[model samples]
Target: MSRMNPVLSFISHNRYWFVIIIGGLLVGVIDDNSFLTRAQYALQIKNLKEQISMYNSQYGRDEQKLNELRRNPKAITKIARENYMMKAEDEDIFVLSDDETNNNKENETTE
Candidate 1:
């Protein structure tokens, strides 16, 4: 077999080097343009503003709920009974599971 010349090998591989050169040119353009940077900054600012608006809306709703809870005595008692599970002074609380109750009724009929 004959030996290949270096110039001929390089000419054959020129397409790969051309791709690298073009990729470098594209990176240089993106890095040099202030418009791309400014656009990215504006998008970040808009996202932050949306997050702040959402937080403000949630905060206002929570504040209104807190104020209503403070002003009303019966509402506070109801909330405490439901959330904290506080019972009245003379009431029997029966905890029933829907599945277990149905099974008990079915077995009672069989017996």
Candidate 2:
């Protein structure tokens, strides 16, 4: 064979190492289950777990409130007053806006 080029000689000497490096790159970056994909999957799993815990806590709170509503007449009235702006026939509901409260405080301070 004609004299091999220096580049070819180097590559021939380390062909196995080159193959291993390229293979590692392909597996780590190009495959479907790549390192990056696995990392993203792990992050998604972590987020889902957090959502599950948050929803579980919220469910527990709602369930407790439901039980309280079933057992206590006051709980139903409180929920109605707080959430639905409801009141008894004789009760007065005072709806105070923040701006009104602020103006009142400013007027008091000025006076």
TM-score of every candidate relative to the true structure: 0.50, 0.78
Candidate 2 per-residue C-alpha lDDT over 1-111 given as tens digits, one digit per residue, 9 for 90 to 100: 345787799899999999999999999999999999999999999999999999999999999989999999998889899999999999898997766334434556665
Give candidate 2 regions above 4 Å deviation.
Answer: 1-4, 100-111
Candidate 1: Cα lDDT at 44:
96
For model 2, give the 10-residue run with minimal summed lDDT: 100-109
- Evaluated at residue 66, the lDDT of candidate 1 is 92
What does candidate 1's lDDT look like per residue over 1-111, in tens digits? 235677677767797787887777676556665567768889999999999999999999999989999899888889878888888999877766667444434656676
Candidate 1 Cα misplacement greater than 4 A, ranges? 1-33, 94-111
What value of lDDT does candidate 1 attain over all alpha carbons? 0.80
Q: Using lDDT as the measure, which candidate wins?
A: 2
